[model samples]
Target: MIISRACPTCRSSLKLTQKDLFDDRYGSPGKHSVFSCPKCGFGKTIPGLNRQNIGKFYARYYPLSNENPKEM
Candidate 1:
């Protein structure tokens, strides 16, 4: 998970904090958040995904590749 904020202008790193929108009262609540960069004046509002996020972990994008065919 991206736990830190990044400067959109300078591509540097910044600190992050929980925004007001990040309420956990809702069961399995979404990750809607607002973050800002300390180096440059860059901020953003990110509406996070809900329960649908589980699918990403189940699908393995790349499977094991076989050794060189000629070596078999």
Candidate 2:
């Protein structure tokens, strides 16, 4: 996918690159994309991470961290 977007600070085109997961303690597993600006070298995740799906991912890794662990 062409997940790259224009840089907010420099208004430059972002380049897509493969990046490994930074940390798996809270979340994040497997490979992901890193969008970077060639002009200013600004880098960030292509997917634009958020806590939207964190509940589902966290629940899978830490069963007891859910609101109702006994339900599982």
Candidate 3:
């Protein structure tokens, strides 16, 4: 399914440019898309992280001092 969003800057509809983009560095769990507003040239990730997911992503995937950062 194609998902579109409104650009925060121009209030224009953002089109999906890239789909199923994954976080290769952190390996966070989620398939995201890149959306670009044709009017404002603004870009954003579809289904952006909220307070809940932000914390979870950091806690689960983000490496701490004790963990090896290059292991991923």
Candidate 4:
């Protein structure tokens, strides 16, 4: 099935390029999809995370400590 959405950048028709993508780095649950805008070549992720979820994901996987950034 081909799914389409409006591009967040240019408001163009975004085509579904990839689906069921998983977050292997953080082992986050749920599947995500990628959409690409043919006009602007911009890409976006479907089912974008809310503010709360974004904070959680960053805190769990990406810490802002002064430690070696490359190690992370």
Clash counts per candidate, in order, are 0, 0, 0, 0
Candidate 3 lDDT, 25-59, residue by residue in tens? 88877788899989989999877777767866777
Pairs in steric clash, model 1: none
Per-residue lDDT tens digits of candidate 4, residues 1-72? Answer: 343488878899888899999989777778889989999999888767677788768777777676664697
Q: Show the lowest summed lDDT stretch of 10 residues, model 4.
A: 1-10
Native-to-model Cα distance after best TM-score fit, residue 45 in candidate 2, in Å? 0.8
lDDT of 2 at 14: 86
Measured against the true structure, the TM-scores of the candidates, in listed sequence, are 0.36, 0.49, 0.65, 0.70
Best by lDDT: 3
Q: What are the per-residue Cα lDDT tens digits for candidate 2 across 1-72? A: 454499977999988765665656655566667888899988887676457876766667667643686776
> Candidate 1's residue-wise lDDT over 1-72, tens digit each?
664355667887755544656444433444556666777757765543346854442233222354454688
Ranking by TM-score: 4, 3, 2, 1
Q: What shift in Å separates residue 72 of candidate 2 from its native position after superposition?
A: 33
Backbone clash pairs for candidate 2 read: none
User: Who is ahead in lDDT, 3 or 4?
Assistant: 3
What is the C-alpha RMSD, rounded to one decimal, of candidate 1? 11.1
TM-score of 2: 0.49
Evaluated with TM-score, which candidate comes out highest? 4
The superposed Cα distance between candidate 2 and the true structure at residue 12, in angstroms, equals 0.8
Q: For candidate 3, what is the lDDT?
A: 0.81
